[model samples]
Target: MLLSDQAGQTAATKIPRPATLRESVIEAIQELIVSGQLKPGQHLVESELAELLGVSRQPVREALQQLSGEGWVDLHPGQGAFVHVPTVEEADQLLAVRALLETESARLAALHAGEDGVRRLRALCARGIAAVESDDVEAAVATNSELHAVVTALSGNQVLAELASQVARRVRWYHTPVARRRGMDSWQEHTALIDAIEAGDEDRAAQIMREHTEHTRASYMEQRGSQPVEPAPKPVRRRRPRTSPTD
Candidate 1:
């Protein structure tokens, strides 16, 4: 309980354990889902995933169970595992909560961000803009997240930053699908947010954050409604041979 006792503890306590197979498998599967390689409602076959991931089925199976518990995957009694399909309402609600948390984060960031913090934001915004210009959706999405993270951290509120960090990962997943569509406009919005923060305009920063999150939510809604239903494959007809002509 005392400083002397704490000093007696070896650095060995700080060394982290290596990831177990199951833990690694879970992370891999989560990456696949987050990258959109595993589409929503797509079947997750243990054997196939094991082969793809170069692990045994046991770890894959365990990973699926853990993911299902986390609401990232769905496990059906007869159907095995499938990626969770987020609903319109779910996306809207999640983004709404994100907006609430981040709007305040931006407000505090404006009040607390130093010149160095503003510089970091500007650098990230430049990267984001370049990514959009090059049509690299993935890179743009990553930079966008990094820029927001800087703003959150600059808020000088540890609790709010932590909450934003937790939501940010899920937000990245949802953002990936819409990144290409959001494109230049998203970066331009970032530009505005950075300006507000640099000017120490707390009200304007908060308003920009709210509108930015709202735009993403609206984009998700539009994307959800616009998903095209695939037409069923038609059966090929075989023509009967003319027996008389063949003879």
Candidate 2:
């Protein structure tokens, strides 16, 4: 049955199944870390995290352990949990892999992207530019990820998309550091990339993606100090539990 609120419009159908508490906590903590609310090397305490997330300590503890396995958190024997501090070596290796994967994705996307796909790319690029102009680093970072995800999905190669997804969040983690510094130039490169894809210039699209990813890699390596970056002030976050349509 559909339900209506004060406006008297259709407000609901069958409500979606809720995420398990542990899953919700895991997603929340991962978001906090990725969005830099939880900084690298900062300690994570179960009770505090539970309070922050309005969940039980059990789920928070489970989330931390799960995150540690995913390399987003560190669980020391006696010192408790800390946000994982990725190293220069780790960044270089992961970003290199991402570059290789995305270059091919761009090439295939150019070869195969339909008119609708091109339109979608243009829309995402515009949003990304606006985010950069507004100096909303988090929004910019999220849009950047969405744009790339679309590129890969347009490739129409399930294997390639899966490969890209594996590294996507890690790539976002690395991109967060360089988003503001890359600024308009990065989005301009994306504009060129979208144009190439729309024109079905596979080689040009591939080359643009390769160079763009490399520029991001160089910016990251150049901007990073000998330690984890000091995160900017945490932006206010409002989030809902994640759901998979297939679930």
Candidate 3:
């Protein structure tokens, strides 16, 4: 009878484990950043974020530290955390890296992608175009990112997928603004890339991807202007004013 009671209790009483505070806080913060609710250079007040996430300051602090390590946040020594803003030079570097990685990914995808992969890529491109047509810049950016991610996954290389995902996160910083300006043309480029992939032309796919990334970098630079120029020093005043007073 004791054994029967023990079994009944074991079956009825489920173990209740609490969610990890750090993970919960991290996910909440990440979602806010990704959705553009917490923009670049925005101050991350620990107490405020903790309140919003329904978590303690400890978890929010740890999450911010982790995000800072991931290059998503900037942790000032005394001022606290803020979202990281990528400089024009940093954006250029990220685009270059993406061009290299994604070109190879596209090449591999072209060689390995079957009809199913092609269909998925087409659907992603269509979604991007529809988003742009609807004037949904954020949706367009998200769909575009998803398309590239799908291409990388089709490559069937886990390491490549990880690298592309990292690059894509950084690229998202530039993509949001660019998509707002570029609109449907961005999706048109996606169409060309997918067409190359569907044709099973590895070389063409790589070439197109490289050119697309370079064009995006150039457009971003053009939008932001060139590097900062130091202001010229003030010229010395003539002695005529003092001479007039003396005269």
Candidate 4:
């Protein structure tokens, strides 16, 4: 069956270069979690995930391991992986830390924000207000995160910005459920914070930011308390089919 072709030609050689399958699966699963398609504490069946992601079980397994290490998924001894259910304590601690970091960020931003920085903050605030007005909670929440991130960036402290970025995604996950409840008030607070920053009122900016984050934390806690936790199912072990010895 030899032909006029290289003997070592391979499937890998024929494929175009792009992200690895494992990385792609990881991002897909994260998106599922972030978008709330995969609820917290929901069971993750490898076969189901493989079918949904159009991938084989092997890459899904590897991605789950990576996600488990990253705190997004919990790997059980025999039950397999489930979405990590955030505890109230974990949310409170993270939000408290965010408040500390962001209040400092607001003060630094007031100290360093130039005309362009102020203008950018105002623009994000405008977008956030518009989203809220239109009742687009998701867009409003996203814009809210962007506005906070810009304030962090305007702080001009690389270390502070890095820390804020690390906690930002998880913050968004918790914030999404409560966005509508906080809607107009959240944007109103943003407007006031922008005003403080624009006026170079460092103390006022810090105070407003602290209050804003605290309000969000309270709203999230209230909403989390209202929702019921889904119970984890007992694992079912598969039984081998019995076969009789034949002579």
Indicate whether candidate 2 or candidate 4 has the larger TM-score: 2
Ranking of candidates on lDDT, top first: 4, 2, 1, 3
How well does model 4 score by local distance difference test?
0.91
Tens-digit per-residue lDDT, 135-191, candidate 1 = 888789889888999999999999999999888877888899889998889989999
> lDDT scores for all predictions?
0.88, 0.90, 0.82, 0.91
Candidates 1 and 4, the one with greater lDDT: 4
Residue range 96-200, candidate 4, lDDT tens digits: 999999999999999999999999998999999899899987789788889999999999999999999999988988888889999799989999999999999
Encode model 3's per-residue lDDT on 1-247: one tens digit a residue: 6877789567656688887879778878876886678877788898899888877799899999999998788877656688877677788888989989999999999999999999999998988888988998788888888998998998888899998887786687677666777776677888999999999999999998888888788877876675332322333445655445563
Q: What is residue 134's positional error in candidate 1, in angstroms?
A: 1.1
TM-score of 2: 0.84
TM-score of model 4 vs. true structure: 0.83
Clashes of 1: 0
Worst 10 residues of 2 by lDDT: 226-235
lDDT (tens digit, per residue) of candidate 2 on 43-100: 8889999899987899889888898899898887756888888888999999999999
Candidate no. 3 TM-score: 0.78
